[model samples]
Target: MNDTFTEADLAPDPQEKRDRLLAVADRVAALVAVLAGGVYIGGMIALGAGAAPIVFSMLPRSIAGDVMGAIFARFDAVALGAALAVLAAEVTRMVAARRRGRTILSRLRRSCTLFMAVCAAYVALSLSPRINDLHRQGVQRDDTPQGQVLEAVHKRAELFGKIGMGMAFGLVVLSVFTIQPRRAEDEEDDDEAAAPLPPGPRDD
Candidate 1:
């Protein structure tokens, strides 16, 4: 090797490469969760003005027949159930991890759990009013510019729901790597901690 050649140019260790890959995977999984949250929130805000409920709290019986009601109502509850299911899954993951004495990263991905919860909440909240509106006011209600914008919003909410699910799944898969197996040293520690207090209640 000549002075022109540098140590930095040497090949990287295989373990180091694997570590880098895992780090990148963790980061990417978190980013996906963030994006999923953004899409859901943006969609609800955009669509609530125009479409009303896009996926929950209401069921659309028809669309073109009632024109405004028919078209807008179609969006009321299509994806609502799926959104709720996702939320439930997230909540279960979080609660279960704590009770099991494990960190979220140990078996469940926290980023994914958070993304699911937020997205689910957004969908549920967004749909509740529209469901109420549809029942209170028939589909024939007047269509405003707000209604027009909301049409897009509902659609975006639906898209985000799918994306959120995908992100959550990816993060869950990644958590396998974060789950550390119990080592002999850990077993020894547990044994040491479990040794009974020396019948000190009477003496102390």
Candidate 2:
């Protein structure tokens, strides 16, 4: 009996190895996107619904504003980071899916992801700083000009926050309902490949 291993036998198939790596990367990207999105959504809900009301009820308006402002300021960094993570993960997943000849996310999913990132950037980069500056300047009275300006800016910020939260919720829903299961997708591809082609015109 001959005991010999050829170079071809010793080496793994490059295509197979590449597919395996791509599969692993795809899973990782999906997991990262989900985790990051969850953190972003949970944080938004907590700050908006749970923390703000409680803090305002317990503390004076001015003090509560300051406290909430500070909390939001800290969370801005987190929100921005989480948003970036989600965007990166989704882009990675998109690339992986394209390589595999699969559709991982729909157009709506991509749009929502982009919108979420934009909203986070706007809040963190534009709105948060303005709010913080107003807080620092100290709005003495709600009726005064400075106070009114602060109120307007604060209201606008809240509006965007609420919009962002809604977008996040919609994204979660779309992800759950729209994304096809990998197994189902694979089976679909198999079915198509297995399907018989229409009979060619009979040769004379």
Q: Which candidate is the best by lDDT?
A: 2
**What is candidate 2's lDDT per residue for 19-107, written digit by digit as tens?**
55666776777667667777888998999999999999999988888898899999999999988887887687677656443444456
lDDT of model 2 at position 124:
88
Cα lDDT tens digits for candidate 1, 58-112: 5443442234333334433433443454445444434433343266454446566
Model 2 pairs whose backbones collide: none
Could you estimate the TM-score for every candidate? 0.37, 0.76
Distance from true location, Cα of 191 in model 2, Å: 16
CA lDDT, candidate 2, residue 99: 41
Candidate 1 regions off by >4 Å? 1-108, 131-136, 139-147, 185-204
Global local distance difference test of model 1: 0.48
lDDT for residue 204 in candidate 1, whole number 0-100: 43
Scored by CA lDDT, what does every candidate get?
0.48, 0.76
Q: Which stretches of candidate 2 lie over 4 Å from their true place?
A: 1-12, 99-105, 174-204
